[model samples]
Target: MRTIYKKELARIFKDKKMVFSVFLLPVLIMVGIMALVGNLTSRQMEDIENHESIVYMMNEPESFTAFLDASDLHMDVKSVETEAERDDVMSMLKEGDADLFIEFPENFDSLIQGYRQGDEVPQIKTYYNPSEDYSSSAYELISNQSLEAYRQVLLSQRVTDMNELQVFTVNSDNKDMVVQDDQKASGKALGMMLPYFITILLFAGAMGIGTDMIAGEKERGTMASLLVTPVKRKSIVLGKVFALMTISGISSVIYIVVMGATFPKILGGDSGLDLEITPEQIVMIGVLLVAIAFLYSAIVILLSVFARDLKEASTYITPAYMVVLVIGMMTMFTTREAGMKDYLIPFYNTALALKGILTSEVTMAQYGVTLAMTLVLGGILTAVIAKAFESEKVMNL
Candidate 1:
């Protein structure tokens, strides 16, 4: 077993191209893609914040105009009272040339001041293009800041005693209002999507390595030579499967490390991601990751054994890869808790476990189920592969 393992490692290491593809390429691709997305997203947000979108006001109120003049919103507002002028502004909004239009009710200020019970509420209608990003952002800023401030001002002006209109304040000092769990919060964001990427990455690496190590060797007649040795068929299977698992394990660590270190810095910007992984959680993640690697490797290697050549093996594995991707993606938006019974399923359990670990939500029993079931299934498949190896018809071309 040791000899076969050492020989396989030597043969793989001798191929520099394979080593680079299996290990280093994943790091570079992850870094490059994350960096590019981060820069583009940040730049877009900054541009929107700094942009001065054109705003048009109809039926202008003297008080509102004065309020706008006194404030520091820096909005560019145009007064278009004529029907023809309003139509022109509407065209500009649809064309993405204008952002927002505000139309106040006639006698807007007088109605607010003299309002009584059952009296009609003063209305302020806003128009903007929802399809345009600038228009949507400008609408949000104006609505949240300028319009809300004006409404508060009107309320205070209408009441004799400002104290009478006000209810008790809640968290006036806004900074201390939120009880933040930075680790848990960041984990929630990551938990939604990281499992999918990790699952895809493990299977992707295993797919190529498994096919080449088994199917490619069989096609080239190298596996036949290895099988004739004095070592038992089980040992040969163990040696090859361990070698596959080693590559899968190393690849898994590389991907997780690279993604963990860089994704926070890039995509998260100043608010970086911090996973609250204790020693125990770290150990669970490691154990779960290994179980998944074994599962993926065994699945691929079994398919490779049944194939006459690399192309035929890939044909069989392609559908399996697609199925894995679908399973991984299913949990990307998972919000509800996963029952312990959910952990009995294969690829799904791994995804759920990772999500729970990141969010600090998974229990010991869930992890136990995922680990036990995965390893048992992998061992069963591996034993099947060994049995197949002993058959003359299965080994020979």
Candidate 2:
């Protein structure tokens, strides 16, 4: 078994194309795509922040106008009083001449004061073209400034202490009681992403090398030569399965490293992701990852053994890849961690377990069950592959 494993590893390493496909491609693709997205996001944010917006106000309140005049926002403000003038401004906004339009109620300040005293609250209408970036930016800027300005006004009238009315207040006494406060948000973000990426990488890495291992050899007439040797058929199957698992595991690890390094930069350092994964958590994640890779490799090996050639193997495996991807996506939409019974499902369990690991939500029992089921399935698949290897017709096919 050791000799067959070493031979399989040597054969795989000797093929430069296989090594690149299984390892380098996933890393390069992930890094390149993330860098591009990060650059685009930064540029868009800069554009939104720096660009001057033109705003049209209908029946503008004197206090609001004074508030805008006091702020540092770069805006070209136009005030219209008559209905005809308001229509003209609306036309200008529609024609892209103006970025945003704000229509205040007839007696804006008086209405707000009245509403505070138990009268009907008047609504402020904002208009912007959703199809235009400048319009959207203008709306965002104006709405934020207006909300803050109004909040301050209300606070001044009602509250004695400004600190008591602040939106976010820190309770320093219980701060340390929050579990992994610094990493909680970042972990959830990573949980939503990494599971899908790792799942896909496992399947993709297996697809390329696993197909070529058995189906390619069958097509090239080299598999028969191996079968006729003194080696046991089960050892050959075990050796090939081990080789596939190694390559797939290597590719997945590369992907995890690249994503972990790039994701913070991708989010522009604003995402407070403190990737402080504990050594124990790392071991748990590594164990779960290896188990899933073993299961995926076995599935691919079975498909490749049944296939006549690489092309047929790929045709069969593509749908399996899609199924894995769909299952991984389930983690993103799921609001909570897996229950006990969920650990029994194959790809879904892997995804749920990964999510649990990332968000620090997994229990010891859930992890143990997931790992056990995956290994059991992998063992069953390996036995089936070994049985098929013993059949002359199946081996030839």
Candidate 3:
């Protein structure tokens, strides 16, 4: 078994294309794509921040104007009179010269105070060209700010003293009790995405090597030669599966390290995510990754053994990869914690377990269930592949 394992490893590593596909391709692609996306996002944010929004206001309130003026947004505010002039402002917006047109109703301040006191509120009209980027951005900023300012005014009138509010008085002392610190929150956010990334890498890394191991060799007439040697068929199957698992595991680790180092920079430096994964959690993650890799490699090996050539194996494996990806995506969008029944599923259990581990939400029961299921599935597939190895027809194919 050891000799066959060593031989398989050596043969796989010797193929430069296979080595690159298994080890370096995922990292390079992840880094390159993340850097590009991050750069574009950073530029868009800078543009939004530095943009000088041209705003036209009709009967604008002094309070709202004061709020905008006190802020650091680069805005060019102009006051206009009469409905006809407001029409001209709308024309400017449509023509792309101005970013926004806001109109406050007559007696705006008195009406707002009245509305806060249970009277009907007057609607404020805002116009901006949705097709224009600057206009849309300006409208979003101005509308949010205006609404917040109005909310503050209403709250001030209703709650003269926050200390006297019953809700505040009760909850003030317990504010820190339920608060998740920056690090934990960051871990949760990263957890949401990391599972999907790792799952895909594991399957992909295993697919290339697993297909080439049996299918490629069979196509090249090398598999028969290796089979006729003085080696046990079970050993041959074990050796190739072990080699595939090793390569897949290595690729997954590289992907994790690369994503960990680069995801923050891509999201922007000030994102304030603290991804301090604990040692225990790291161990859990490592175990989960190994289980998932083993399961995926075993499945790939089964497909490869059944295939007559690399193309046939890839054709059979592509849909399996897609199924895994779709399952991973479903796990990514999951808002709730994993239930007991969730661990009963195979590929999906790995994704949920990964999420739980990263977010520090996994239970011992869940971990045990996922690991057990994965091992059972892997063992079953390995047995099937070993049986196939002893079949003359399968070997001849």
Best by lDDT: 1
Q: Write the per-residue lDDT of candidate 1 for residues 159-186, one digit (tens) a residue.
A: 7788887688887768877787888888
Q: Candidate 2, which ten residues in sequence have the lowest lDDT sum?
A: 175-184
- What is the TM-score (0 to 1) of candidate 3? 0.80
lDDT of each: 0.85, 0.84, 0.84
Off by over 4 Å in 2: 15-18, 61-63, 79-98, 105-123, 129-133, 147-180, 265-268
Score every model by TM-score. Answer: 0.88, 0.82, 0.80
Which of candidates 2 and 3 is the stronger one according to TM-score? 2
Per-residue error (Å), model 3, residue 146: 4.3
Q: Mind giving the per-residue lDDT tens digits that candidate 3 earns over 1-397? A: 8887888789768989867877888878878887898889789878977889999988888877776777756789999997788878888998999999888888887786666456677778888999888999998888767656766665687678855754534565675777667776887788778877887778887888789889999999999899889999999999888878877877887788788888887787788876888889878888777778888999999999989999999999999999988988887677776799999998888888887877777799999999999999999999999999999998887
Per-residue CA lDDT of model 2 for 1-397, tens digit only, reads 7787788788878889868866888788877887898889789989978888988888778878877877867988888779998888788788888898888889887776666566676778888887788888888778766656776776687668887866785775675666655676778889888888887777888888789889999999999899999989999999999988887787787788778887887777677788778888788888887888899999999999999999999999899889889988988998754689998888788878877877788888988988999999999999999999999999988
Pairs of residues at least 3 apart in sequence or in different chains that clash in candidate 3? none
Residue 264 accuracy (lDDT) in model 2: 87
